[model samples]
Target: MSHSPAPRRRIPAPRPADGFMLLLEAARDLRTVGAVAPSGKALARALTEPVRAQAGQPLDILEAGAGTGAVTRTLIPQLAPGSRLDVAEANPRFAHRLSELVRAHPHLAGRPPEQVRVHDVHVERLETGRRYDVIVSGLPFTNFSPHHVEAIMDRYLELLRPGGTLTYFAYRGTGRARALLASPAQAHRHRAVERLLAAYRDRCATGRRTAWANLPPATVWQLRRPAYAVEHSGTRAATAEGAGGAGGVPGPAGVPRTGL
Candidate 1:
Protein backbone atom coordinates (compact mmCIF):
# COMPACT_ATOMS: atom_id res chain seq x y z
CA MET A 1 0.00 0.00 0.00
CA SER A 2 1.37 3.39 -1.05
CA HIS A 3 1.09 6.12 1.57
CA SER A 4 -0.19 9.46 0.33
CA PRO A 5 2.49 12.15 0.17
CA ALA A 6 2.51 14.30 3.23
CA PRO A 7 0.87 17.69 2.83
CA ARG A 8 3.32 20.46 1.90
CA ARG A 9 4.60 22.16 4.97
CA ARG A 10 4.70 25.96 5.11
CA ILE A 11 7.76 27.58 6.58
CA PRO A 12 7.10 30.38 9.07
CA ALA A 13 8.09 33.81 7.95
CA PRO A 14 10.78 35.72 9.82
CA ARG A 15 9.50 38.41 12.16
CA PRO A 16 10.85 41.94 11.91
CA ALA A 17 12.96 43.30 14.70
CA ASP A 18 10.72 44.04 17.71
CA GLY A 19 7.62 43.03 15.75
CA PHE A 20 8.07 45.58 12.96
CA MET A 21 5.32 48.22 12.59
CA LEU A 22 3.87 47.31 15.98
CA LEU A 23 7.12 48.37 17.55
CA LEU A 24 6.89 51.69 15.75
CA GLU A 25 3.35 52.09 17.03
CA ALA A 26 4.43 51.48 20.60
CA ALA A 27 7.28 53.98 20.29
CA ARG A 28 4.90 56.54 18.79
CA ASP A 29 2.43 55.98 21.61
CA LEU A 30 5.15 56.48 24.22
CA ARG A 31 5.88 59.93 22.83
CA THR A 32 2.18 60.73 22.51
CA VAL A 33 1.41 59.77 26.09
CA GLY A 34 4.21 61.98 27.36
CA ALA A 35 3.19 64.93 25.11
CA VAL A 36 6.74 64.94 23.82
CA ALA A 37 8.16 65.64 20.39
CA PRO A 38 8.40 63.01 17.64
CA SER A 39 10.50 59.92 18.40
CA GLY A 40 13.53 59.61 16.14
CA LYS A 41 13.29 55.88 15.39
CA ALA A 42 13.45 56.43 11.67
CA LEU A 43 16.61 58.41 12.11
CA ALA A 44 18.01 55.85 14.49
CA ARG A 45 17.41 53.12 11.92
CA ALA A 46 19.11 55.23 9.28
CA LEU A 47 22.12 55.62 11.54
CA THR A 48 22.71 51.89 11.97
CA GLU A 49 24.36 51.52 8.57
CA PRO A 50 26.77 54.41 9.05
CA VAL A 51 27.54 53.29 12.57
CA ARG A 52 28.35 49.80 11.37
CA ALA A 53 30.62 51.22 8.68
CA GLN A 54 32.50 53.47 11.08
CA ALA A 55 32.63 51.34 14.19
CA GLY A 56 34.06 48.23 12.39
CA GLN A 57 34.34 46.23 15.62
CA PRO A 58 31.66 46.01 18.28
CA LEU A 59 30.51 49.44 19.41
CA ASP A 60 30.45 50.95 22.87
CA ILE A 61 27.36 53.16 22.63
CA LEU A 62 26.07 55.90 24.91
CA GLU A 63 22.38 56.52 24.36
CA ALA A 64 20.66 59.63 25.77
CA GLY A 65 16.89 59.95 26.31
CA ALA A 66 16.39 56.30 25.52
CA GLY A 67 12.67 56.53 26.41
CA THR A 68 11.47 52.91 26.58
CA GLY A 69 14.81 52.00 25.04
CA ALA A 70 13.08 51.60 21.69
CA VAL A 71 16.16 52.58 19.70
CA THR A 72 18.43 50.99 22.25
CA ARG A 73 16.41 47.81 22.03
CA THR A 74 16.87 47.75 18.29
CA LEU A 75 20.56 48.65 18.38
CA ILE A 76 21.88 46.32 21.08
CA PRO A 77 21.01 43.09 19.36
CA GLN A 78 22.91 44.18 16.28
CA LEU A 79 26.15 44.83 18.14
CA ALA A 80 28.96 42.25 18.38
CA PRO A 81 30.10 40.55 21.54
CA GLY A 82 32.14 42.49 24.17
CA SER A 83 30.64 45.81 23.09
CA ARG A 84 29.65 48.00 26.03
CA LEU A 85 26.76 50.43 26.51
CA ASP A 86 26.11 53.43 28.73
CA VAL A 87 22.74 55.14 28.86
CA ALA A 88 21.69 58.42 30.47
CA GLU A 89 18.05 59.43 30.63
CA ALA A 90 16.48 62.67 31.83
CA ASN A 91 13.22 61.09 32.93
CA PRO A 92 13.53 59.12 36.13
CA ARG A 93 10.45 57.02 35.46
CA PHE A 94 11.60 56.09 31.98
CA ALA A 95 15.13 55.52 33.19
CA HIS A 96 13.87 53.04 35.76
CA ARG A 97 11.94 51.23 33.06
CA LEU A 98 15.05 51.15 30.87
CA SER A 99 17.00 49.66 33.75
CA GLU A 100 14.34 47.01 34.13
CA LEU A 101 14.40 46.28 30.42
CA VAL A 102 18.16 45.80 30.48
CA ARG A 103 17.74 43.33 33.31
CA ALA A 104 14.99 41.46 31.54
CA HIS A 105 16.74 40.93 28.22
CA PRO A 106 19.60 38.49 27.73
CA HIS A 107 21.35 40.53 25.04
CA LEU A 108 21.28 43.60 27.27
CA ALA A 109 22.22 41.71 30.42
CA GLY A 110 25.69 41.15 29.03
CA ARG A 111 26.50 44.82 29.59
CA PRO A 112 27.85 45.84 32.98
CA PRO A 113 25.53 47.37 35.57
CA GLU A 114 27.85 50.34 36.02
CA GLN A 115 27.51 51.13 32.33
CA VAL A 116 23.92 52.26 32.70
CA ARG A 117 23.37 55.39 34.79
CA VAL A 118 19.74 56.48 34.79
CA HIS A 119 19.85 60.02 36.11
CA ASP A 120 17.18 62.69 35.87
CA VAL A 121 19.65 65.24 34.61
CA HIS A 122 19.79 66.89 31.20
CA VAL A 123 22.44 65.85 28.66
CA GLU A 124 24.56 68.94 29.22
CA ARG A 125 24.81 68.31 32.95
CA LEU A 126 25.26 64.54 32.66
CA GLU A 127 27.93 64.67 29.95
CA THR A 128 30.36 67.20 31.39
CA GLY A 129 33.90 65.64 31.51
CA ARG A 130 32.47 62.20 30.56
CA ARG A 131 33.33 60.85 27.13
CA TYR A 132 31.77 58.24 24.85
CA ASP A 133 33.02 56.27 21.87
CA VAL A 134 29.62 56.55 20.16
CA ILE A 135 26.70 58.68 21.26
CA VAL A 136 23.11 58.14 20.06
CA SER A 137 20.58 60.76 21.12
CA GLY A 138 16.82 61.23 20.84
CA LEU A 139 16.58 64.53 22.69
CA PRO A 140 14.22 67.11 21.11
CA PHE A 141 16.51 69.88 19.96
CA THR A 142 13.48 71.49 18.27
CA ASN A 143 12.17 72.24 21.77
CA PHE A 144 15.27 74.21 22.69
CA SER A 145 16.24 77.83 22.06
CA PRO A 146 19.32 79.03 20.14
CA HIS A 147 21.39 79.41 23.31
CA HIS A 148 20.25 76.02 24.55
CA VAL A 149 21.26 74.47 21.22
CA GLU A 150 24.73 75.98 21.48
CA ALA A 151 25.05 74.73 25.04
CA ILE A 152 24.21 71.20 23.98
CA MET A 153 26.66 71.38 21.08
CA ASP A 154 29.45 72.43 23.44
CA ARG A 155 28.71 69.42 25.59
CA TYR A 156 28.92 67.11 22.54
CA LEU A 157 32.27 68.59 21.52
CA GLU A 158 33.72 67.89 24.93
CA LEU A 159 32.09 64.56 25.66
CA LEU A 160 32.73 62.71 22.38
CA ARG A 161 36.01 60.81 22.43
CA PRO A 162 38.59 61.24 19.69
CA GLY A 163 37.75 58.87 16.80
CA GLY A 164 34.26 58.52 18.24
CA THR A 165 30.98 59.22 16.40
CA LEU A 166 27.76 60.95 17.45
CA THR A 167 24.34 60.30 15.88
CA TYR A 168 21.09 62.24 16.34
CA PHE A 169 18.12 63.28 14.17
CA ALA A 170 15.16 65.67 13.91
CA TYR A 171 11.91 65.85 11.95
CA ARG A 172 11.96 68.39 9.14
CA GLY A 173 8.77 67.91 7.21
CA THR A 174 5.28 68.53 8.60
CA GLY A 175 1.91 69.10 7.01
CA ARG A 176 0.00 72.38 7.31
CA ALA A 177 -2.38 70.89 9.84
CA ARG A 178 0.47 69.60 11.93
CA ALA A 179 2.22 72.95 11.69
CA LEU A 180 -0.92 74.78 12.81
CA LEU A 181 -1.26 72.35 15.68
CA ALA A 182 2.29 73.13 16.73
CA SER A 183 2.72 75.84 19.35
CA PRO A 184 3.47 79.43 18.34
CA ALA A 185 6.95 78.99 19.86
CA GLN A 186 7.78 76.38 17.21
CA ALA A 187 9.18 78.99 14.83
CA HIS A 188 11.97 79.78 17.26
CA ARG A 189 12.43 76.10 17.94
CA HIS A 190 12.83 75.48 14.23
CA ARG A 191 15.56 78.09 14.15
CA ALA A 192 17.24 76.38 17.05
CA VAL A 193 17.27 73.10 15.12
CA GLU A 194 18.69 74.84 12.07
CA ARG A 195 21.53 76.36 14.06
CA LEU A 196 22.30 73.05 15.69
CA LEU A 197 22.56 71.46 12.22
CA ALA A 198 24.80 74.30 11.12
CA ALA A 199 27.14 73.48 13.95
CA TYR A 200 27.11 69.83 12.84
CA ARG A 201 28.18 70.91 9.38
CA ASP A 202 31.05 72.89 10.82
CA ARG A 203 32.15 70.36 13.39
CA CYS A 204 31.11 66.76 12.60
CA ALA A 205 33.67 64.36 11.12
CA THR A 206 31.08 63.18 8.53
CA GLY A 207 30.34 66.62 7.10
CA ARG A 208 26.89 67.51 5.64
CA ARG A 209 25.88 64.25 3.92
CA THR A 210 22.30 63.22 4.75
CA ALA A 211 20.34 59.97 4.76
CA TRP A 212 17.35 60.28 2.45
CA ALA A 213 15.76 56.87 3.00
CA ASN A 214 14.41 57.58 6.47
CA LEU A 215 10.69 58.21 6.92
CA PRO A 216 10.97 61.93 7.64
CA PRO A 217 14.43 62.14 6.07
CA ALA A 218 17.38 63.05 8.29
CA THR A 219 20.94 64.28 8.30
CA VAL A 220 23.66 62.17 9.92
CA TRP A 221 26.69 63.72 11.62
CA GLN A 222 29.73 61.55 12.37
CA LEU A 223 32.87 62.96 13.95
CA ARG A 224 36.27 61.40 14.52
CA ARG A 225 39.80 62.68 15.05
CA PRO A 226 42.39 61.49 12.51
CA ALA A 227 44.79 58.77 13.69
CA TYR A 228 47.74 61.14 13.43
CA ALA A 229 45.79 63.82 15.25
CA VAL A 230 44.97 61.39 18.04
CA GLU A 231 48.63 60.45 18.41
CA HIS A 232 49.84 64.06 18.49
CA SER A 233 48.92 65.73 21.78
CA GLY A 234 51.39 68.58 21.53
CA THR A 235 49.64 70.38 18.65
CA ARG A 236 46.26 70.21 20.36
CA ALA A 237 47.88 71.60 23.53
CA ALA A 238 49.23 74.62 21.67
CA THR A 239 45.81 75.42 20.25
CA ALA A 240 44.22 74.98 23.65
CA GLU A 241 46.76 77.25 25.31
CA GLY A 242 46.46 79.93 22.64
CA ALA A 243 42.65 79.84 22.82
CA GLY A 244 42.84 80.21 26.61
CA GLY A 245 45.11 83.30 26.66
CA ALA A 246 43.70 86.78 27.08
CA GLY A 247 45.68 88.15 24.12
CA GLY A 248 44.71 85.43 21.61
CA VAL A 249 42.41 86.35 18.73
CA PRO A 250 38.74 85.57 19.19
CA GLY A 251 36.97 82.58 17.66
CA PRO A 252 33.81 82.95 15.57
CA ALA A 253 31.16 85.26 17.04
CA GLY A 254 28.64 83.59 19.39
CA VAL A 255 30.67 80.35 19.40
CA PRO A 256 30.73 80.39 23.25
CA ARG A 257 33.47 79.32 25.71
CA THR A 258 33.60 76.22 27.89
CA GLY A 259 31.40 77.82 30.56
CA LEU A 260 29.43 80.29 28.49
Candidate 2:
Protein backbone atom coordinates (compact mmCIF):
# COMPACT_ATOMS: atom_id res chain seq x y z
CA MET A 1 0.00 0.00 0.00
CA SER A 2 1.24 3.54 -0.77
CA HIS A 3 1.80 5.78 2.24
CA SER A 4 0.35 9.33 2.35
CA PRO A 5 2.90 12.18 2.20
CA ALA A 6 3.15 14.60 5.12
CA PRO A 7 2.75 18.30 4.55
CA ARG A 8 5.75 20.57 4.68
CA ARG A 9 6.07 22.78 7.75
CA ARG A 10 6.04 26.51 7.09
CA ILE A 11 9.25 28.27 8.05
CA PRO A 12 8.73 31.45 10.04
CA ALA A 13 10.57 34.67 9.18
CA PRO A 14 13.78 35.39 11.04
CA ARG A 15 13.13 37.63 14.04
CA PRO A 16 16.08 37.07 16.26
CA ALA A 17 16.72 39.93 18.76
CA ASP A 18 14.28 42.35 17.13
CA GLY A 19 12.73 43.52 20.39
CA PHE A 20 16.06 43.75 22.16
CA MET A 21 17.62 45.70 19.31
CA LEU A 22 14.71 48.12 19.24
CA LEU A 23 14.98 48.73 22.97
CA LEU A 24 18.69 49.35 22.74
CA GLU A 25 18.29 51.69 19.79
CA ALA A 26 15.51 53.54 21.58
CA ALA A 27 17.59 53.96 24.70
CA ARG A 28 20.53 55.20 22.66
CA ASP A 29 18.47 57.67 20.64
CA LEU A 30 14.79 57.86 21.41
CA ARG A 31 14.32 60.82 19.08
CA THR A 32 15.37 58.88 16.00
CA VAL A 33 14.71 55.23 16.92
CA GLY A 34 11.33 56.32 18.36
CA ALA A 35 9.80 53.12 19.70
CA VAL A 36 10.87 51.01 22.66
CA ALA A 37 9.64 47.86 20.95
CA PRO A 38 9.26 46.44 17.47
CA SER A 39 5.90 47.04 15.86
CA GLY A 40 3.35 44.25 16.40
CA LYS A 41 1.95 42.12 13.59
CA ALA A 42 -1.43 43.87 13.73
CA LEU A 43 0.22 47.21 13.14
CA ALA A 44 2.25 45.79 10.29
CA ARG A 45 -0.89 44.48 8.64
CA ALA A 46 -2.62 47.82 8.98
CA LEU A 47 0.34 49.69 7.51
CA THR A 48 0.57 47.33 4.52
CA GLU A 49 -3.15 47.42 3.79
CA PRO A 50 -2.73 49.56 0.69
CA VAL A 51 -0.34 47.02 -0.83
CA ARG A 52 -2.82 44.23 -0.18
CA ALA A 53 -5.61 46.28 -1.70
CA GLN A 54 -3.59 46.61 -4.88
CA ALA A 55 -2.71 42.95 -5.12
CA GLY A 56 -1.70 41.34 -8.44
CA GLN A 57 -0.41 44.58 -9.93
CA PRO A 58 3.32 45.20 -10.17
CA LEU A 59 3.96 48.22 -7.92
CA ASP A 60 6.75 50.49 -6.81
CA ILE A 61 6.77 50.59 -3.01
CA LEU A 62 8.82 52.62 -0.56
CA GLU A 63 9.16 51.90 3.15
CA ALA A 64 10.68 54.64 5.29
CA GLY A 65 12.10 54.04 8.73
CA ALA A 66 11.82 50.24 8.59
CA GLY A 67 12.90 49.26 12.10
CA THR A 68 14.05 45.74 12.76
CA GLY A 69 12.07 44.53 9.71
CA ALA A 70 8.74 44.13 11.52
CA VAL A 71 6.70 45.54 8.65
CA THR A 72 9.31 44.46 6.11
CA ARG A 73 8.62 40.78 6.80
CA THR A 74 4.89 41.36 6.35
CA LEU A 75 5.55 43.33 3.16
CA ILE A 76 7.88 40.83 1.45
CA PRO A 77 5.24 38.10 1.26
CA GLN A 78 2.73 40.45 -0.32
CA LEU A 79 4.88 41.75 -3.18
CA ALA A 80 3.58 40.67 -6.55
CA PRO A 81 6.04 39.50 -9.20
CA GLY A 82 7.80 42.44 -10.93
CA SER A 83 7.05 44.74 -7.98
CA ARG A 84 9.94 46.66 -6.43
CA LEU A 85 10.48 47.69 -2.81
CA ASP A 86 12.91 50.28 -1.56
CA VAL A 87 13.52 50.48 2.18
CA ALA A 88 15.03 53.67 3.64
CA GLU A 89 16.26 53.59 7.21
CA ALA A 90 18.45 56.44 8.48
CA ASN A 91 19.96 54.36 11.24
CA PRO A 92 23.02 52.49 9.96
CA ARG A 93 22.63 49.52 12.29
CA PHE A 94 18.93 49.24 11.45
CA ALA A 95 19.72 49.51 7.75
CA HIS A 96 22.21 46.66 8.03
CA ARG A 97 19.64 44.57 9.86
CA LEU A 98 17.06 45.31 7.15
CA SER A 99 19.52 44.19 4.46
CA GLU A 100 19.90 40.89 6.27
CA LEU A 101 16.13 40.51 6.48
CA VAL A 102 15.76 41.16 2.76
CA ARG A 103 18.37 38.52 2.02
CA ALA A 104 16.83 35.82 4.21
CA HIS A 105 13.21 36.56 3.37
CA PRO A 106 11.75 33.31 2.03
CA HIS A 107 9.34 35.08 -0.27
CA LEU A 108 12.22 36.91 -1.95
CA ALA A 109 13.99 33.66 -2.73
CA GLY A 110 14.97 33.29 -6.42
CA ARG A 111 14.13 36.95 -7.06
CA PRO A 112 16.62 39.43 -8.47
CA PRO A 113 18.68 41.31 -5.87
CA GLU A 114 17.45 44.60 -7.29
CA GLN A 115 13.87 43.79 -6.34
CA VAL A 116 14.34 44.98 -2.74
CA ARG A 117 17.09 47.22 -1.40
CA VAL A 118 17.85 48.84 1.96
CA HIS A 119 19.27 52.35 1.83
CA ASP A 120 21.19 53.78 4.74
CA VAL A 121 19.82 57.28 4.38
CA HIS A 122 16.95 59.47 5.38
CA VAL A 123 13.84 59.23 3.23
CA GLU A 124 14.08 62.90 2.35
CA ARG A 125 17.68 62.38 1.28
CA LEU A 126 16.94 59.31 -0.84
CA GLU A 127 17.56 60.56 -4.38
CA THR A 128 15.79 57.81 -6.29
CA GLY A 129 14.05 59.38 -9.27
CA ARG A 130 11.30 56.79 -9.25
CA ARG A 131 7.93 57.62 -7.74
CA TYR A 132 6.12 54.97 -5.75
CA ASP A 133 2.62 53.50 -5.85
CA VAL A 134 2.60 53.06 -2.07
CA ILE A 135 4.79 54.49 0.66
CA VAL A 136 4.79 53.05 4.19
CA SER A 137 6.43 55.24 6.83
CA GLY A 138 7.41 54.10 10.32
CA LEU A 139 9.02 57.35 11.37
CA PRO A 140 8.21 59.02 14.68
CA PHE A 141 6.97 62.35 13.37
CA THR A 142 5.90 63.57 16.78
CA ASN A 143 9.47 63.57 18.01
CA PHE A 144 10.82 65.78 15.24
CA SER A 145 10.89 69.56 15.01
CA PRO A 146 8.11 71.17 13.03
CA HIS A 147 10.45 72.16 10.20
CA HIS A 148 11.89 68.64 9.99
CA VAL A 149 8.44 67.10 10.01
CA GLU A 150 7.30 69.38 7.21
CA ALA A 151 10.37 68.58 5.13
CA ILE A 152 9.82 64.84 5.48
CA MET A 153 6.14 65.15 4.62
CA ASP A 154 6.98 67.19 1.57
CA ARG A 155 9.52 64.60 0.48
CA TYR A 156 7.00 61.80 0.97
CA LEU A 157 4.41 63.51 -1.19
CA GLU A 158 6.99 64.30 -3.85
CA LEU A 159 8.18 60.70 -3.93
CA LEU A 160 4.66 59.31 -4.42
CA ARG A 161 3.24 58.99 -7.91
CA PRO A 162 0.00 60.74 -8.71
CA GLY A 163 -2.86 59.21 -6.72
CA GLY A 164 -0.39 57.05 -4.81
CA THR A 165 -0.95 56.35 -1.11
CA LEU A 166 1.24 56.93 1.93
CA THR A 167 0.59 55.16 5.22
CA TYR A 168 2.10 56.12 8.57
CA PHE A 169 1.33 55.40 12.23
CA ALA A 170 1.48 57.31 15.48
CA TYR A 171 1.12 55.71 18.87
CA ARG A 172 -2.01 56.61 20.81
CA GLY A 173 -1.83 58.71 23.99
CA THR A 174 1.43 60.39 22.95
CA GLY A 175 -0.17 63.81 22.85
CA ARG A 176 -1.60 63.40 26.33
CA ALA A 177 1.73 62.20 27.65
CA ARG A 178 3.55 65.11 26.06
CA ALA A 179 1.14 67.58 27.57
CA LEU A 180 1.43 66.00 30.99
CA LEU A 181 5.14 65.28 31.27
CA ALA A 182 6.96 67.43 28.73
CA SER A 183 8.32 70.89 29.41
CA PRO A 184 6.57 73.92 28.00
CA ALA A 185 9.01 74.28 25.09
CA GLN A 186 8.87 70.58 24.17
CA ALA A 187 5.10 70.54 24.39
CA HIS A 188 4.91 73.64 22.25
CA ARG A 189 7.17 72.05 19.63
CA HIS A 190 5.02 68.92 19.63
CA ARG A 191 1.90 71.01 19.10
CA ALA A 192 3.54 72.80 16.24
CA VAL A 193 4.42 69.52 14.56
CA GLU A 194 0.85 68.34 15.05
CA ARG A 195 -0.53 71.44 13.42
CA LEU A 196 1.80 71.04 10.46
CA LEU A 197 0.67 67.43 10.10
CA ALA A 198 -2.95 68.45 10.54
CA ALA A 199 -2.73 70.73 7.53
CA TYR A 200 -1.44 67.86 5.37
CA ARG A 201 -4.16 65.57 6.72
CA ASP A 202 -6.78 68.14 5.92
CA ARG A 203 -5.54 68.30 2.37
CA CYS A 204 -4.61 64.70 1.46
CA ALA A 205 -5.95 62.24 4.03
CA THR A 206 -7.72 59.31 2.33
CA GLY A 207 -8.44 57.11 5.35
CA ARG A 208 -7.50 56.30 8.93
CA ARG A 209 -7.41 53.07 10.95
CA THR A 210 -6.44 52.12 14.47
CA ALA A 211 -4.41 49.06 15.46
CA TRP A 212 -5.36 48.31 19.01
CA ALA A 213 -3.50 45.03 19.17
CA ASN A 214 -0.20 46.82 18.79
CA LEU A 215 1.96 47.66 21.77
CA PRO A 216 0.55 50.95 23.19
CA PRO A 217 -1.91 50.92 20.25
CA ALA A 218 -1.49 53.14 17.20
CA THR A 219 -3.40 55.06 14.55
CA VAL A 220 -2.51 54.59 10.90
CA TRP A 221 -3.26 57.45 8.53
CA GLN A 222 -3.45 57.03 4.79
CA LEU A 223 -2.92 59.99 2.46
CA ARG A 224 -2.98 60.22 -1.31
CA ARG A 225 -0.99 62.57 -3.48
CA PRO A 226 -3.20 64.72 -5.66
CA ALA A 227 -3.00 63.63 -9.28
CA TYR A 228 -2.46 67.22 -10.42
CA ALA A 229 0.72 67.70 -8.41
CA VAL A 230 2.63 65.13 -10.43
CA GLU A 231 2.65 67.06 -13.67
CA HIS A 232 4.00 70.20 -12.03
CA SER A 233 6.62 68.37 -9.94
CA GLY A 234 7.76 66.31 -12.89
CA THR A 235 8.38 69.44 -14.90
CA ARG A 236 10.32 71.02 -12.05
CA ALA A 237 12.42 67.89 -11.42
CA ALA A 238 13.24 67.64 -15.10
CA THR A 239 14.29 71.27 -15.14
CA ALA A 240 16.50 70.79 -12.09
CA GLU A 241 18.12 67.68 -13.45
CA GLY A 242 18.64 69.40 -16.81
CA ALA A 243 20.30 72.35 -15.09
CA GLY A 244 22.53 69.97 -13.08
CA GLY A 245 20.94 71.13 -9.85
CA ALA A 246 20.85 69.24 -6.54
CA GLY A 247 17.67 67.38 -7.40
CA GLY A 248 19.62 64.18 -7.04
CA VAL A 249 22.22 63.61 -4.37
CA PRO A 250 24.89 60.91 -4.55
CA GLY A 251 24.63 57.91 -2.25
CA PRO A 252 27.19 57.62 0.53
CA ALA A 253 30.25 55.41 0.32
CA GLY A 254 29.70 51.67 0.85
CA VAL A 255 25.93 52.16 0.29
CA PRO A 256 24.62 50.25 -2.71
CA ARG A 257 22.67 52.23 -5.28
CA THR A 258 18.98 51.29 -5.36
CA GLY A 259 18.86 52.06 -9.14
CA LEU A 260 15.13 52.63 -8.82
Question: Tens digits of per-residue lDDT for model 1 on 1-260?
Answer: 99999655332222233244335544655431222323445556665554566454656667776766666666666666656667777766567766666665565454666544556577778743455667776765655544555567657655666666677665545324346775545543454446545644454447434557555565665554322222211111111212211111123342322221
Cα lDDT tens digits, model 2, 36-124, are 88899999999999999999999999999998888998998899999999999999999998987787676787799999989999998
**What are the lDDT scores of the predictions, listed in order?**
0.54, 0.81
The clash number for model 2 is: 0
lDDT of 2 at 42: 94
TM-score of each: 0.63, 0.84
lDDT of 1 at 106: 60
Q: Give candidate 2 regions above 4 Å deviation.
A: 1-16, 230-260
154: Cα error in model 1, Å: 1.0
Whole-model lDDT for model 2 versus the true structure? 0.81
With a 3 Å backbone cut-off (N, CA, C), the pairs that clash in candidate 2 are none
Residue 34 CA displacement from its true place in model 2, Å? 1.0
Model 2, position 54, has a per-residue lDDT of 93
Pick the TM-score winner: 2
